[model samples]
Target: MALAYFVLGDADRGRANLRDYYLAIGPDHADQIARSAGTHTVALKETIESFAAIGADELILLPGLDDVNEVDRLAEAVL
Candidate 1:
């Protein structure tokens, strides 16, 4: 959503946090995983926009160790 981008300006930072949570909790922590992935989704859109706003030629998304569906949704929203 545009509002997500409006709030979080940096995707990289958001992704980092997501990775940290996942690493700490591992795959079995569904509740915490959902929360982290939700946050990551918001950050992903912001990150793409942030890069676009800076005039990047190409966008590369690397959603390391996440809920694939959640990541797919975010990627669809962004690209």
Candidate 2:
């Protein structure tokens, strides 16, 4: 969505794109996430793996990060 804003120069479209994919985390899902947070280091690793498995391209994830190196790493893939 951020990429949409950047490329199209349309804030509304970017917001619309974001809204299209937005999932409202209800009580049950939130509770499950909270329960999962109580575990050790591997919990985070597993969660990230699951997220990765859900399939997002580099461009979609780029604008959300703060690291220049990671941005550089994924930028080429987007291009």
lDDT tens per residue, model 1, 19-58: 4655766755533443433344456666666767877857
- For model 2, residues 15-41, the per-residue Cα lDDT tens digits are 343334343655555433333331223
After superposition, the stretches of candidate 2 with alpha carbons farther than 4 Å from their true spots are 1-30, 57-79
Worst 10 contiguous positions by lDDT, candidate 2 = 1-10
Q: CA lDDT of 22 in candidate 2?
A: 41
Q: At residue 8, what lDDT does model 1 achieve?
A: 27
Best by lDDT: 1
Candidate 1 Cα lDDT to native: 0.48
Using TM-score as the measure, which candidate wins? 1
Consecutive 10-residue window with the lowest summed lDDT within model 1: 1-10
